[model samples]
Target: MMLSHYLIVSGILFSIGFLGVLLRKNTLVVLMSLELMLNAVNLLFVAFSRYNLSLDGSIFVFFSITVAAAEVAVGLAIVVALFRLKQTVFVDAFNEMKN
Candidate 1:
């Protein structure tokens, strides 16, 4: 119920997401981790907004969710295309994309 609680949880979520993005090789896991990180930021915005007694944070979260939805759609499509081309979801497999 306290601001500290929200901050701690948000920090944990962000850390986990950051590690997942850094240590995982799977593209899907990386994408999910990115989502986790984004959600953590959203939680912080909401907590601060509530603490400040304003609706701005919630409104920002709404738009953030909308953008995240669009990102997932496009990201998944790209992943699907990559899989079709390479037969694997591991990030390392796409190194040839540089060429």
Candidate 2:
């Protein structure tokens, strides 16, 4: 496939994820959407790396994957904690966390 094909796919994935994040009220769904967005970016990076014959994009993808993993771990931990405290996973329910 061409670079434009990869970019188009990435754009679609990112837009879907962005809409999910914007419209979903559930924290878990939002997290999954965030992961989708991250994966879209990774896909773009890999595509660029393949077309350009450079190691830098792959290296960046490795770090991005690491960071995404850490983000999921911490995000899920927070979700679990919030669920334990409030018995719900809705984002609006987290407003009390300020206290």
Candidate 3:
């Protein structure tokens, strides 16, 4: 399709992901939402790359995916550790960290 179509889809995905991150209480869900947001950005990058007929955006997308993978690994590990300590993954339940 056209670049506009891709942009619209990416924007919608980003909005949904943003809302998910803002409204969810579970840390796991939040992490997933964050990934959703990242993917949306990746989608935009690829769309622009395709439109411009250049590899730069695709290269950026590759690196973004790599970084996102690392983030997921570290984020999940932290979530698991927090769950072990508190027996819950809800962000509200970890108010002890507020100090």
Candidate 4:
């Protein structure tokens, strides 16, 4: 696919992920949206790397994936802790921590 095509796809995926994050009430869905957004970014990076015929963007994508993996690990830990304390996966239930 061309760079523009990849960019469009990435944009759409990012928007969908943004909507999911904003509209979903469940904590798990929110986390998944974040992952989707990350993947979209990775796609964009790879596409640009191919377009430029350079390893820079691809190398960054690799680092991004690694960071994303770490993010998932920590995010899931927080989610598990929240579920244990609240007994529900709803985002609203986490509001008490705002203080």
lDDT per model vs. reference: 0.96, 0.95, 0.97, 0.93
TM-score against truth, every candidate:
0.94, 0.93, 0.95, 0.94
Residue-by-residue lDDT tens digits, candidate 2, 55-94: 8999999999999999999999999998999999999888
| Candidate 1 structure quality by residue, lDDT tens digits, 1-99 | 999999999999999999999999999999999999999999999999999999998899999999999999999999999999999999989998598
Model 2: residues with Cα > 4 Å off, grouped in runs: 97-99
Error of 1 at 74 (Å): 0.5
Best by TM-score: 3
Please give the TM-score that candidate 4 achieves against the real structure.
0.94
- Cα deviation in Å at residue 39, candidate 1? 0.8
TM-score of 3: 0.95
Q: lDDT by residue for model 3 over 1-99, one digit each (tens)?
A: 789999999999999999999999999999999999999999999999999999999999999999999999999999999999999999999887589
True-structure Cα RMSD, model 3: 0.9
Q: Which candidate's lDDT is highest?
A: 3
